[model samples]
Each structure stands twice: as C-alpha cells, then as structure tokens.
Target: MYNNASVNKVFLMGYVAREPRIHNSKNGKPQLSFSLTTTESIKTQGGDIQHSEVHAIKINADAACLKDVNLKKGDMLYVQGRLQTHAFVDEQLIKRYKTEIVAIGVELFDPIQL
Candidate 1:
C-alpha cells in the first residue's frame, strides 16, 4: 500500500452484515460504523444451489449523511470511498487487523430504476 498518494480509493455495493450505529470521536467528529457482506448464489439446472460468501468489512461513514439515511441490517447500500486498514488490540492484548471502508458517500440501492 502506498501512503500519501491520495489515490487509494474504491467503491462497493453490498448488504450490511449487521446494524449500523453512530458515534462521535473524542474531537467531536461524527462516525458511523457497520459491517458489509457480499454474497453470490447460483442455481444449477438440476435444481441444485451453490453459494459463496465474503467476510464483512467494517465501514465508517462521515457524519454529514448519518442523519439522512437509515442504515439497517440486510439493506442494500451503495458505498463509494477508499479502503482503509484499522488496527486494534483485543481482550488479551492480541493484535487485530481490520480492513474498513472509509466512506466518501453512501446511498440506498434501488434496482427498479436500473
């Protein structure tokens, strides 16, 4: 990963693995955290089904749009932004690495218009 390039951006569209919640940073910045899950299913001609799943991504959204849209589990969301890595220490001082989407923007996913 290149640092200080300012070009490490990406967009994702998927379902939430869990509910979303809002919080404030110590410096008063707004943050919304949630998880994302991507899945794909296929049905064989013989009536058999197969599925694939992806681990959730922790996403943090800006506060400006937090109060505008309602984030719920299983809701289809369109997210646009950069990919970021967050680190933390767990219960017993175990180091954990998490990849999160630092959202630049988000919106409800509507397929009817597509």
Candidate 2:
C-alpha cells in the first residue's frame, strides 16, 4: 500500500433513491437526475455488516440515445461518471456548494421480480 497521486474517481454501485427525472436542456440535450444509495462493508470481531449512503447523480445523454426507451420512476440503473462540485448563489445571495455524480453513461438493470 502506498499514498500517491490524488484520487478523485470512484466506482459506485447502489440502488436508486428515487425515480429518474428526465428533462431536456434549452439546447435540447437529454438529461436526467436521480439519487443512488450505496452500501459500505462494515467489519468487526462479530462479523460484517453493510452500511449505506444515498448519493445524488445527474445523467446527460444524447437525444438519439434517449429515443424509444421509456425511463420511469423506481428504475434500477448503473451510472458511470465523474465527481463534480457545484457552487451557486441562492435567493438569499449566500454562496452554496453541493457535490454530485455527473454521469457520462447510464445502463438500466432488470426490474426486481416479485
């Protein structure tokens, strides 16, 4: 093990916190927003347990990629993207910052069977 270059990339696997929000930008690019919950492995003398955290993500796709496929709420998806931080001023004129996963690729997983 060694401490080296700054590590900023992450590969995440989790369940969707909510339904995907599909929208179009003013320039007509297809975009979506959703949250994912990921679990971490917890270990101790007793055994192992999984801890989870919910993350917010944004997915941007080309118009052609969004055709015919109907994405709905509560859909299971896999997202590969980069970590991004957004800083903005709210209505109160106070500066605010938030971090989110900006997706470059999205894949839908099979639905959960009953």
Displacement of residue 12 (Cα, Å) in model 1 is 0.8
Worst 10 residues of 2 by lDDT: 61-70
Q: List the candidates' TM-scores in order.
A: 0.67, 0.66
Model 2, backbone clash pairs (residues 3+ apart or across chains), number: 0
Error of 1 at 5 (Å): 5.3
How much is 84 displaced in model 1, in angstroms? 1.6
Estimate, for each residue in 1-114, the C-alpha lDDT of model 1 and write its tens digit: 777665777666778778877777557765777777765567788885656444344344554545578889888877777777878999999999987677767777765665
Q: Clash totals for all models, in order?
A: 0, 0
Q: What lDDT does each candidate get?
A: 0.70, 0.74
lDDT of 1: 0.70
lDDT of 1 at 76: 81
Query: Deviation in angstroms for 109 in model 2?
Result: 2.3
Alpha-carbon runs more than 4 Å astray in model 2: 1-8, 24-28, 61-69, 90-94, 111-114
